[model samples]
Target: EPEVTQTPSHQVTQMGQEVILRCVPISNHLYFYWYRQILGQKVEFLVSFYNNEISEKSEIFDDQFSVERPDGSNFTLKIRSTKLEDSAMYFCASSERGVGELFFGEGSRLTVL
Candidate 1:
């Protein structure tokens, strides 16, 4: 089965910079999501995208963050103006529909200094 995959397994960046994480979700899935976990914290939802628009988003997703499909095969998350508190493991996930199981990628770890 096709599963979600993420790139640049780890990213180390300086404060005030920008970072873009990439993901490829299962081709047949209809929902895509971005979630994050700060070092010892629980996973938090950032945003959900479906039908080319944002379906839902959490408070953690602020003006500094944006999500885009860009093209049919790729989904990306951009974080502008990095802050030290933004360091976390960002996960890319997808589901056949928004209600049930969600398949998650290994994640892209972001380290801000």
Candidate 2:
């Protein structure tokens, strides 16, 4: 079955650098999400998109972060300036109806030094 795929499986960057994580969500799915887990912490919701627009976002998704669907299948998450605290595993996910079971990518690991 087709699944969400992310690039640069792992990345190491200096603080204040920019990072753009990419993903190709399931073609038939209608909703997309960007979630992150800070090392040992629980997964946190960053943003959700549907119908080509963000449906909702969490407080953690401040001006430093943004999400986009650059094409029919490509979805992306950009961190304007990486911080040491931003180091974590970022996951891209999709669901057929924006709820219920979600298909998740293996995740892009970010390391900010």
Candidate 3:
């Protein structure tokens, strides 16, 4: 079975820098989402994308953040300026339907200093 794959499983960056996290989900899945978990905090939703447009987003997805499906096969999340608070484990997920089980990738951990 195909699963979601994320690149650079671990990333270290300085505050004020930019970072792009990449993921590739199962080929037939439709709804894609980005979620994050701060070191000691609960998992939070960032944004959801479908049909090449943003379907839903949380307040955490602010001006500093953006998502894209540059190619049909991969999805990406870009943070324009990093902050210490931005350090978190970002997970990429996809589901065949909008309301079912979401298959997730091994999170990409971001560390900002």
- In model 3, how large is the Cα lDDT of residue 73? 96
The 0-to-1 C-alpha lDDT of every candidate, in the order given, reads 0.95, 0.94, 0.96
Quantify how close model 2 is to the true structure by its C-alpha RMSD in Å: 0.8
**What TM-score, over all chains together, does every model reach?**
0.97, 0.97, 0.97
Better of 2 and 3 by TM-score: 3
Worst 10 residues of 1 by lDDT: 1-10
Specify the highest-lDDT model's number: 3
lDDT of 2: 0.94
> In candidate 2, what are the lDDT values of residues 36-108, reduced to their tens digit?
9988889999999999899999999999998889889899999999999999999999999987999999999
Query: In order, how many clashes per candidate?
Result: 0, 0, 0
Higher-ranked by lDDT: 1 or 2: 1
Which residue runs does candidate 1 get wrong by more than 4 Å?
Answer: none
Candidate rank order under lDDT: 3, 1, 2
Ranking by TM-score: 3, 1, 2
The alpha-carbon lDDT assigned to residue 101 of candidate 3 equals 97
